[model samples]
Each structure stands twice: as C-alpha cells, then as structure tokens.
Target: MSTKPQFGADIETHHTRFDVDRYEDIYVVGDVHGSLDALKRLISRLELNNDDLVIFVGDLVRKGPDSPGVVDFVRADPCLVSVRGNNEQKILRGDKDPDWLREGDREYFESLPIAISFDTVLVVHGGVDPERSLEDHATDELLTMRSPHGDGYDGPFWYDDYDGPHRVFFGHTVHDRPVEREHAVGLDTGCVYGGELTAYDYRNDEFRTVASKTHQDRASSKVVDPA
Candidate 1:
C-alpha cells in the first residue's frame, strides 16, 4: 500500500482512475456500513478470482458492528477498491471518528477516490450532478447528495435527469429494494439498517444481495428521511 498524506476538504482535487479492460470481472457493491459478516457471505457467493475486481460504493464504517474488520478485510486484498462515502468523508473531515478506526486509517480514507469509472459505468457513493461531466463533478454532490433537485428546483431523482451515456451506479439513498433507472442504479439497500447488501455485476448486468444477518433492530430506520 502506498503511504499518502491525509487529505482534507481539498481532497477532491485528487482523483484516481482505472481501466476496466484490465480486469476480468468487475463487481460493484453498495454501502457496506460495517456489515462485515454480510459482506463476507456475499463475497463467498461471488466466488471471486484473482482477476476479479470488487469495488465498494463506500460507507464501509459506522452504524454497525465490526467496522475495523471490514476495513481490514478490504485492505488485505489489492483487488478490492472503495470509493469514499459520506460517512467516510465525515470521518476524514473529523466529524466522526469511531474507536474502531486506528492509525493510518485516516490516510486510507483520504486516499480514496470520490468516484470510479469503468467502461460505461460510473460508480460512486452518491449520485453525481446531471449537468456536469464526470471529471468536473463537485465533490460535495458526489459525497452527500440524496435527491436530484435542490435550491427550490423540483424535479425527479438525479438518475431520471441523467442524459449521459455512462450508467451511474451509486449508494447513499437507502431503498426497500434496489432502485433501477434508465442510466443509474442504486444499490444501497440499507445493509446497516437490517436490509440487504447488494452487489452489481457489471460484466453480466446482474445483481446479488445478501440479507442482513445483524442489526435487525434497526430495520425501521431504513426509511428515507423526510426532506
């Protein structure tokens, strides 16, 4: 692993890009939220290989038990990549740092990219701006955005207005089920709230989900917060 400085709000100026053609299978996962057991079960089902790429939509910590375990598991393998989520940004921004996070964890989170592009798919922790190109996307919108409209602009979900050719796969907004739109797909099935942990196979356009085995008491909290 490379040692990089812990970035602050200016982290958006640095981004990482990857070429999908370099891997055989590319799997994108939704908000993990520290459900290590669920994530393990889901990975077991995938039967991943050396050439496979597992990209997490982030929120790897907070709101659930075993956050450190999740971080360790992902960091142990080079095939796994995670985009920074709002919860991660909160931690990186010194908003919330759980006891589980240890030394060097901040650097790891700071080094994470805001979004990842693979072929025609763009994976992010949150939805992107419909009006801006991926390279010009605002870091705030990519990390914390929920609905599509803002500032008194009423409209449909962000994906509904997406006219880009690249399909956007994201997490952040929890749904009872995965939300599928024309150019976007939401996989944050609220795993931290006792919902399913979802993963999308970009190679086959298929989805796999593992029901939450822990934190069932938090199920009711999965509902979207009122705007």
Candidate 2:
C-alpha cells in the first residue's frame, strides 16, 4: 500500500507511488468511461480474492451512462483504486460541475494519484515521456499525451521509442486491442464506444476483457492514429 502524500494540489509535484505487494493478483484496468455494467461483468469474470487489488487507469466518468454509479462502485470497494485521468481533472477544475456528480465524488477523484507504482511497473492514465525522469513529467503529458513528438494525430507514439527503467501501463489512447510493447502496455480498448472493457492481470501477464454495450456510437472504431 502507499503512504501518505499520494495526491497533491499541484500536478508538478511528484506523486507518491503505491508500493503494493502481498496481493494474489494485481489487475491493471483500462478506462471504464462510466460503463458500469461492463466493469461489473469484467470483475465477475476475475473472481478476485480479498487481497487481490485492481488499479484502474482512470476515466471512470463521462461519455457513457451511469457515471455516478461507476464512481460509487469504485469508492465503496476497498480493493479498487485509480489514477486521476483528464476527465476527472476536468470535473475538478471546470467552472460548472456535471449534473451526474454527487456528493463525495469530487473527493474520490481528488484522492487519486497521478501514477501507481509496483517494483517494476508504473501505471498512469496517459503516456509518460521516456526522455525525462518520472519526477519531471508535466501534468498535461501524464493526462492527455498521445504522440511523442507533439499533441498530433500521427506517430511515432510516446512508447515507440521507450527504453524504460519501469514498464508503463497506460490508457487514454483507444486501440482496438491492447498495445503491447517491451516497455509500454496500453489497455484503453474504448469500452464506451462499443469496444471491450479491458484489464491486465499483472501477476499472470494476461488480459481479461468483456464485451461492452455501446453508449456512444460516434468514433467507435479503433484509434490507429489519434483522431
């Protein structure tokens, strides 16, 4: 488990990593995007033990039905934790809160760290810059980065050239399937847009996914290059 000083008011502040251990299995999940039913089904399939931990890459709200429900489920469950995604940041920083937001949801989002760390892996909502030390990464890159070159819709991606100290598991960029690289594993399968809700079992190195019901039909296809 992580110590205190996990979440900070400033993004540039280095986040405290969860040095988690003693779990039967560690499941790293992609963006749920408020697909609560799909998330439930995926959890049911895992048959997780009490000690088994699930770390979500974030985007637990917006773009689908049941955003409030998704937040409530994760908040109630002790085994589940998450990083803060761009969507969550939007809600916290926006002038207007969404109607679906309930009491205590903001605190939950605020509690999420920018990254979760295992001995050899790091989990973030979006990609990290391989060229910089983890402590030096900016908040915007950790939340919304897609291309390594710039915020463009074309390659090469952030992980394409990574030769890492720790393998990074991330989401935010939707792919038809998980992106597998030596140093990066992308699990955002676009669940809100009719793709599968995906999760990676870290101990087993296996992917557990469930078919998702489409809530938003626009841009439902795989993102080869960003759109």
Best by TM-score: 2
Model 2 CA lDDT for position 223: 66
The lDDT of model 2 is 0.83
Kindly list the per-residue Cα lDDT of model 1 for residues 159-203, writing each as its tens digit.
667766667788887777887777888888889787899998878
lDDT of 2 at 226: 30
Per-residue error for 42 in candidate 2, Å, reads 0.2
- Residue ranges of candidate 1 with Cα displaced over 4 Å: 1-13, 151-155, 214-227
What is the per-residue lDDT of model 2 for residues 75-155, given as tens digits with 9 covering 90 to 100? 888999898999999998984489998888888888888877776688889888777766566787898878767875466
Task: Kindly report which residue pairs in candidate 1 clash with one another.
Answer: none
The models' CA-based lDDT, in order, is: 0.78, 0.83
Off by over 4 Å in 2: 1-16, 220-222, 225-227
197 in model 2: Cα distance from truth in Å?
Answer: 0.5
Instruction: TM-score each candidate.
Output: 0.85, 0.89
Worst 10 residues of 1 by lDDT: 1-10
